[model samples]
Target: EDALYQKLYASLKNRELATKDRTERNSMFARRYPSHAQEESKKQHDHFSLKAAQSDASVEASRLRRQQHFTELASIMKSSNESRINSASERARHHFATVQGEREGKWSNTRQRFDEIRSREQEQRDQIAEMRIIHSNELSFRGTKNSGSISPTSTLRAQTPGSISYFSNNDDETAKTGAVADRLISRILKAANSGKHRRPSEVGSVFESSNCVSSLNTSPSREKPREIDDNATDKTQI
Candidate 1:
């Protein structure tokens, strides 16, 4: 191409040389084509910087997306874990409460049984003492009859001195005697119960007289007062 440009210029000026000096031509070519490689290199550098910036932006976007995803997943996992822990705690509390209730019920039942047994034993003791006093009173009443302080009318029995006989007739005097006997027994029971603390109904339970219709055949006053031996009164209560 340089040779072609030189020939065209020589033809235009009508000058030809077999060995032409190329200094001016070389200088002109150098001036015109100067630093094209450097410009291309600069352009390449700019392109590389642009590509690097784009790659960095893509990488930063991807990293941000990854962080966001991780944050959301972590939040979900944390919420799920907290919920599970709360559920477990609630179940444990319920189980603990159930066990506590059952334990309390068992303890209450056992204590109630113990109290019942203790009450029964105390009632038996009181009954035995009451029987002994009733026996002693009978002996004293018999002594009073023998001393003529009282006369035996309808109370005489074939078996024992203090024993009573049942009246075949339901006369007014016989009914009065039975009524007196009932009142006397009630008074004795009340006296025995006076020193103790109990429900009024429970203390009064013993005063419910024998069934009147069935017992009228053998009145309460007609009940035989036999001699009670030592320790026999306790057995009678039993």
Candidate 2:
């Protein structure tokens, strides 16, 4: 406040004395002397006013010099404060980025670990299930092999016992037919076996058996069908 008042006062005095010179002051003295002829009093007042204006000029010049220093100090302080603020902001941003990156990395690693653990666990479970199935199959196969409840041979016999007996009877009947056919072929054709037919019971039985070729009551050995046909053909040719 005091500085501002002094500056204002100096500005007013400078304006008043800005154009002051010997010629201008003499002109003012001439005009004022004709109006009021107190030469000594006017000269003393003019000298005092000149001295006051010089003092005011010196004070104003000193204040303006200090103003230059004040302006330079204010600019330096402003730049320092701005630089400090910028550096602080940069540090804050860097810290935040680092923290965020670390947090995200930790989360990523944790997720990967969990997934790997789960995959291993799932694989272990599958292996256990496969082992259980293999063990069951092995047990079942061993039981089937060792147990005699349902063997392949027994199953086959059980399924075809009647059919097997029937086939055997049919084979016996074919053999009996063949034997009678042979006897007939020899008798009708007078073959080399006439001595056998000389037995009446054998001759009668041969004729009877020939009529029952489909019968399955033959206890005699089987004869080949080809041999029977050959004998018949020989009788026909004869």
Q: Evaluated with TM-score, which candidate comes out highest?
A: 1
Clashes of each: 0, 0
Which regions in candidate 2 have their CA more than 4 angstroms from the true location?
1-37, 124-238
Candidate 1: residue 45 Cα off by (Å): 1.4
- Candidate 1 matches the true fold with a TM-score of 0.42
lDDT of each: 0.57, 0.52
How does candidate 2 score on lDDT?
0.52
Question: Per-residue lDDT for 1-238 in model 2, tens only?
Answer: 9999999999988877865765587678878686554676688899999999999999999999999899999999999999999999999999999999999999999999999999977766665555455434433322111211211111101123111111211223334434444444444334222212246676456646555333433333453122112222111110
**lDDT (Cα) of model 1:** 0.57
